[model samples]
Target: MMTKLGPLLLVLLLAGPESSCGDNPRYEKFLRQHYDNPKSSFSGKYCDSIMAKRGLTKPECKEVNTFIHETKNNIKAVCEEGGEPYGNLRRSKEHMKVTTCKLKGGSTRPPCKYKENSSPRYIVIGCENGWPVHYDESQIVTTVDNADLD
Candidate 1:
């Protein structure tokens, strides 16, 4: 009985420390040291004075705020056509082709065109044209797999 009890006690002692590790004590300590613990930079001079007063650092607040702002921007851009924070225009999935577009006077690299992949494959559009106009089946949106797009 004594021998069996000794093994059980050792196992319990070893497992106890591992269970506490799941709390991410290392990460928590790091966060407290840099962002939350004593003399937090967010205090008084920053936007969230209460949090700051409680010892949140300026960098910590800034990181969280920036992440929120970026997430909002991404959501907006993914759904809408204009005023995206990243300034990338939303494009249609069809009715456009990648072709060499030439400038009226100067030479430009191959440009995207409003044309179908078959039957007169290339139809040039003005550089300032925002999006391609639909004319025929040839004017199909270039397909990209989600993984490739990413």
Candidate 2:
């Protein structure tokens, strides 16, 4: 019995920490981390202040990240009927403005300097029960005619 249960436990363990049973706490954390919009306009200080204030660079620097300039309701619509299924993620039908922040080379560790660039993009995200659980990536919609757009 113990031997049989061992494999079952292993499979469950291999599934990792994410469970789509309910509203995941990670979804809220994702919102907090990646969903801020510029009030006036994005500035040179945007990434620096936002990242540090949001605690992404506290213990160590995050390698890369993006912030979407839209409300949660708009982002939530990506998982609805309009979203295209791309593997385990849903791709947004509408384009959104996003700012990509990359860690600057040779920057001090604690200070974790970043360079930012903003662009229009369609986002891919993982959703369960119509709520976003993961931010996949921002995509440039080059193929408006292509059905396989991801």
The best candidate in terms of lDDT = 2
| TM-score of candidate 1 against the unseen true structure | 0.16
Weakest 10 consecutive residues of candidate 2 by summed lDDT: 138-147
TM-scores of the models, in the given order? 0.16, 0.72
lDDT of 1 by residue, 92-148 (tens): 322222221111223222221111112112221111222211212222234543764
The C-alpha RMSD of each candidate to the native structure, in angstroms, is: 22.5, 11.0
- Please state the error at residue 127 of candidate 2 in Å: 0.8
After superposing candidate 2, which stretches have Cα over 4 Å from the reference? Answer: 1-23, 38-44, 106-108, 138-150
**lDDT tens readout by residue for model 2, 29-119:** 8777788855324355878777887788978887677888876777777888757787778878778788777888864467788888788
**Candidate 2 lDDT (Cα, 0 to 1):** 0.74
Question: lDDT of candidate 1 vs native?
Answer: 0.28
Model 1 residue runs over 4 Å out of place are 1-19, 22-26, 30-47, 57-150
